[model samples]
Target: ITPASMTIVFLSITIGTIMTMSSSNWLMAWIGLELNMLAILPIISKPKTTRASEATTKYFLTQAIASAMMLLSSTINVWQTGNWNILELKNKFSTTIMALSLMMKMGAAPIHFWLPEVLQGTTLQTALLITTWQKIAPVTLMYMISNNIQPTILVSAGILSMIIGGLGGINQTQLRKMMAYSSINNLGWTITIMAFSPNMALMNICTYIIMTTPIFLMMTNMST
Candidate 1:
């Protein structure tokens, strides 16, 4: 049941990613994000155990907050710029809002408190999906908007994620949580290079996935 539910969640997140990638409007992107969140809620709670329920609640609350922020940012952007086109972002305030929302969505630093806790509660395979496939959409969107995002904000978030991910992993007992932190650190590397070369960012993302897959598989095998 858990695996099946997770598969459905993965598919939903893929759909959300497609929506996000193809969306020209902010509202559409928000809808896609909401879809992703809603799909994953069940997966987070599938264990039918206390820890899973706690994690699901925490994830739900965190995602709800992020969704609210996304809505607020979109509303502000529309009000200030009188436009909803994702690529039409022009005002500094709107751009900043969009960036903040994306940062939160991608589990970037300072806004990344939910990731470890959530991963700690899930099965390893679910963690793999969250760390890998589920990340594709937001990161792709971030790469697309890299030119508009503030360099300082990206740098700060990237650095913080790297430091926190590395330091946080040192004491983690659960292997899944450790991998989640590793994913965060890798995301930091990807974001850091995004400012320098968009192509490099793409390369980093590809390489990270390729490298991380084997590690995740190994852990899954060992755990079982």
Candidate 2:
């Protein structure tokens, strides 16, 4: 993409997250999320290497499914309650679907199969972006609907993510791959805390991101 195009894509990504983060309705949030998804694929594919191609394809497929699930869940909620509010997801089935979709989107277990492979194939910068930046919208929406989702589901996924993150990386050779699992593990803590306290969940995410910064920077320096 040209510099101008890249600028527009990033702008779209920004607009998407802003919409989701600031909106009252699920429609606006869903739209924003789709825009972010569209913008990110191009950014991930810019290198045009075989590895980059594979990464973008995998990411697109995974996110497409997750996005579809979000749309479905939100629409179902609207149908059931005759409301479009993000903060008032009342349908039990819809809430479950939404939670599962977000877990998939965030690469939390047992739907986390794509994260490690995608990270292994993308550039260090892109992988880092996926690990941190791309998480905000889904996690924010998760926070919004946290009260509606089942705590048992969140707790189970959180525990599994932590377990997998720890066990899967025991023999990793690539630093990026290890960090991918670490991202999953850190996300587990956030999800676990989400069921009881959104504030603590956000805190966990913030602390994890801060800790990740220097590690990613060091990896970047090493790569260069």
Candidate 3:
């Protein structure tokens, strides 16, 4: 890619993520997420291979489904509570839908099937972004609605994620797929603690990034 194009892509991604993180209303958050999703597609498909194209398509479809669910949840909440504020998610059904959508976006639990395939098809740097930076907005949204979502669902998904992540990676030879499973496992821990302690969930995510970054950087340098 040209330098100008790369710069624009990265800037848009950053701005999109920041917008999602800072937005007070669901509409703004949805827009930010869409922008982020669009910005990352080119990066994921940069290799111009069939696998890259497949990965991009899978990522887009999965994210679009999650985003639509999120918007629908917000609409339900607005209908019930007449509020557009993120923190005003008082409707039980909306809260559950919102939580599930965020978990799907973050590649957690039973809905995490797309992550490994997507990571395997992308370059190392793009994989790194998928596992780390792209997670922040969804996690932030989860955190914001932590009080509203049912703890049992979050805890159940978290436990399932940990188990599946561990079992799924045992036979994988591909480094990117292994990292995908690892991210799911770590996210399980974060989501488990999110309902009980939001601060701890944040800390867990921060630590995951710190620990995972070095490994990805080393792998990239070695061309692995």
Candidate 4:
């Protein structure tokens, strides 16, 4: 992508994430997610290699599925509750599906298989974006609805993510893939804490970003 086009995509990504984070309704959040997904595609495939193409396709499919699930759950919620309010999720089935979909979007485990592969195929900078900036919207949404989600499900998923993330990274040689697992691990901790304290979860994410950004930048500078 050209500099101008890159600038535009980056802006779109930012706007999309902000839209999702700030939206009070599920429809707007879904639209923001779609925008975010679309904007990131070009960045993922910019290298134009076979691996990059594969990663782009994988990412698009995974995100599309998650977004579709989110939309379906939200629609179900609207059907049952007669409102589109984010804080008004009352249908049990819809709530579970929405929670799972948000987890999928953020690459929390069991559903986390796509992440390492996608990161490994992209440039380090793109991988950095995948692990960091791409997380905010979904995490924010999850936080918004934390009260509606079952604590048991949240705790189980969180613990499973932590286990998988830790165990999965041990044998990885690729730096991007390793970071992917690490992202999973850190997010797992965040999710676990979010079950009891959301503010702490938010602070954890901020801390993760601050600590992670420089490492990725340094690796990028060294072309490692």
Candidate 5:
């Protein structure tokens, strides 16, 4: 990637996450999510290889679906509540749809079929960003909407993700796939904690980022 493009990508990533984290408005969070999504596609597709191209395509499609869901959920939310406030989510159907959309975006269980494939197809650095930084915006939104999300839904997704993450990793030989499962497992833990304590959810995410960074950095050049 050119220096200019790389700078924009990095800056967009920061802007995207901050937009979601700081915004009380759902549209602002969606904007941030879109910025983050658009920025990462170029970065991951920079490699001059077919796998990179395919990975980028798959990532784009998956995120597009998630983004569409997010937008639809927000639209319904506003229609019902006549408000765009993130915390004003009161409708059961809207809450469920929004929660599921964020879960899919974050690659949570039962809806995480895209994660391993994308992680395996992309370069280590891009995979790192997808597994770590890419989650910030969606997870932040999840926490903000935690109050409205059903406990049963959260617990179901969390347990299923943990099961899949754990079982899926046992038979994986590739490093990235294994790490992808590990990310899924950690996300499960985060979602579970999100049910009872938003602060704990954020703390778990912080700790996961801290621990995963050095490990992925070390694995950057270490092939599968």
Candidate 6:
């Protein structure tokens, strides 16, 4: 039951990501986020362990807050700019808010405290999905709007993610938590370089995926 529920959750997140990546309107993106959050809630809570339940509550609460912030930011953007088009994010402040929300949703630094705990509570397969597939949509959106996003903010997030990730993982006993932190570190590398060159950002993402895929596959095989 757990595995099946997790599969459904994965599918929902994938679909939500697709919706978010393709949508040009702010409301549509919000719907996609809602879908992603709702889908993953079941997976987090299904383990039926005390730690798992606690992690689920944490994940859900954090996501809800992020979602609310995103909506508020979008509303502010629309009110100030008189446009709902995400592509026309001319208001710098709103764009910053949106970027921050996205970073939070992706489990980036400062807002990343929930990730290790959540990953620790899940199975290896679920962790793999969280690290990889769940990232696709948010990263795609980040890349799309990179031109408009503030360089300072991006750099700060990237550096914080790298430092926190590395320091947090060194003493971890759980393999899942270690991998989660490793992923955060890799995302930091990607975001850090993204500000220097778009081409390098793409390369970083591709390379990270290539390097991580084999490890995840191996873990899955061993777990099975």
Best by lDDT: 3
Residue 96 lDDT (model 5): 92
Please report the TM-score between candidate 3 and the true structure.
0.99
Candidate 1 per-residue lDDT, tens place, 94-193, comes to 6676666666767777788888888889887777777876677677767777888778877888898899889988998888888878888888888888
lDDT of 6: 0.82
Clashing pairs in 1: none
State model 4's lDDT.
0.94
For model 3, residues 66-145, the per-residue Cα lDDT tens digits are 99999999999999999999999999999999999999999998889999999999999999999999999999999999
Residue pairs in candidate 4 whose N, alpha carbon or C atoms collide under 3 angstroms: none
Q: What is residue 188's positional error in candidate 1, in angstroms?
A: 1.3
lDDT of 4 by residue, 154-190 (tens): 8889999999999999999999999999999998998
* Backbone clash pairs in model 4 (N, Cα, C under 3 Å; residues 3+ apart or in different chains), count: 0
Model 6: ten consecutive residues of lowest lDDT = 125-134
Which ranges in model 5 have alpha carbons more than 4 Å from their true place? 221-224
Q: Which of candidates 2 and 6 reaches a greater lDDT? A: 2
Model 5 residue 161 distance off true place after TM-score fit, in angstroms: 0.3
lDDT (10s digit) by residue, model 5, range 1-224: 78987999899988998998899998998999999899898888888789888888988998999999989999999999899999999989989989989999999988899999989888888888999999998998998899889988998899999999999999999999999999999999999989989899999988999899888998975656
TM-score of 5: 0.97
Superior candidate under lDDT, 3 versus 5: 3
- lDDT for model 1: 0.80
lDDT of 6 by residue, 169-205 (tens): 9999988899989988888887777777867887787
Q: How many residue pairs clash in each candidate?
A: 0, 0, 0, 0, 0, 0
Please estimate how well model 3 matches the true structure, expressed as its whole-model Cα lDDT. 0.95
Q: How close to the true structure is residue 31 of candidate 5, measured as C-alpha lDDT?
A: 95
